[model samples]
Target: AIDTVKSSAATWTEPAQSTTAAATASVDAAASSATDFMENANAAETAAASEAEASALSIGDYITAGKTRSQIQGYGGYTDIGGTILTIESITDQTITFSIVQYSDSGYAADTVSAKQITAQWVKNTAAFEFCDDTLDGKGYGTLSYENGTIHIETRSNTNHPTKLVLNEDLVGT
Candidate 1:
């Protein structure tokens, strides 16, 4: 009877040890999975923030109160250098309108020059805007970049002439 009891007890102890080891393995696997999920989620969030920072300017942001208008002088081109004013008229969700106010820099009140309205739309995949109006006369497009309320704009002609404009934080009336 004693021999039979000892054998039965040994059999039970072996199965019990195996069960404990299996439970430990399951717990380790679950912990590893949780850590992987957390790491993946964090990486995804960081990527989203980076994309947002690189996003193009929104027209609505330029049309808000106390941020309505900006005036920039042109540079880098013989026709536009020191003789032009790029006046920001208004910005819509799909379009931006501005006027190229020209002046005769020859120190004479000679002739009357009209302001030309140039309208443009945002270009796909380039993060820039393209002028489709008659005012450009086959010149190229414009691109805008903003940071901390300061805006930088560049208009490039087809001949590779680039006119740069910088807008500071002071608000101007339309």
Candidate 2:
């Protein structure tokens, strides 16, 4: 009778040991999976920050401003009516105003035309607006003014020669 009792107790102990081993293995696998997920998330955040910094431009990017005709004469001489140089004085989100100086034989001349004599046109990304001269023989110069989200052009002919256009914005148009 004592031997039968001892055999039954041994059978119960074996089953309990097997169950405990399985539970411990399951816990270890769950911890490993959580660690891998955290590493992948950190890598993605770093890449996004780098891309945003590269896309923006500063005021110094306006280096194209104030280039003289003598400097650019190698590329193309400023002989015709379209040889005007643009100098970006100030720029903002809504407006950009610059000084327009034409390469004259005498030097740089003021573009003075009545507001009514100038015609305004709008283009895409290259130039926001263009001011053209309104005349029969096309012998007037125009000045461009960007203010309050609108462009104003003043066109006038040289007092000495009407045939010679002074500040021709058509030369600068792309």
Candidate 3:
């Protein structure tokens, strides 16, 4: 009886250790998966923040704002430099009916978007909303300025494809 008991004890201890190790491994894997999911969720939201901005803005209120380099994945990033908001007429889902304000540079009262130098609206597009142009990621859309909360997009490259608008960062949906 003693011999049988000793043998059983040794065998049981090995399986118990194995079981514990397996459980530990499973728990670790689950934790890793959960962490990955949370990271991906946050990344997805940041990437799609621009879309959310487009849907929730008023005319005159800037759809695009701030200075950030345009990524080259889409159409072809607009070589933005940076500018201030001037005036805005409208920024609807179908049309960004801006009230085109005059972006001041030195003594230039003339309007039209500057080259990729006037940094504004890092993410603006027409394909998702207008169904016309791709991303229009060519040159600087223009220099935008602000006048009493109204916005203006002044650039020489205003084409038929209505530029899609991106909302300011503070307004992105959480």
After TM-score superposition, the amount by which residue 156's alpha carbon in candidate 3 deviates from its true location, in angstroms, is: 12
The lDDT values for all models are 0.48, 0.42, 0.40
lDDT of 2 by residue, 90-140 (tens): 445555545443434433334322112222232332233333333323344
lDDT of 3 by residue, 76-129 (tens): 334443333323344444444433222322222232232221212323432111
Model 3 root mean square deviation, Cα atoms: 14.2
In model 3, the runs with Cα more than 4 Å from the true position are 3-7, 34-38, 51-86, 94-97, 101-174
Error of 3 at 171 (Å): 22
Ranking by TM-score: 1, 3, 2
lDDT of 1 at 142: 60
> Which candidate comes out best when scored by lDDT?
1
Clashing pairs for predicted structure model 2, backbone only = 82-171
Candidate 2 least-lDDT 10 residues: 56-65
Model 2: CA > 4 A from native: 1-6, 53-174
Error (Å) of candidate 3 at residue 98 is 3.8
lDDT of 1 by residue, 1-174 (tens): 999999999999999999999999899989999999999999999998877755534333232123212212222333422233345666666666665433343323332132345666734322365543232334456665455443445555555532322222222222
> Would you estimate the TM-scores of all the predictions?
0.34, 0.29, 0.34
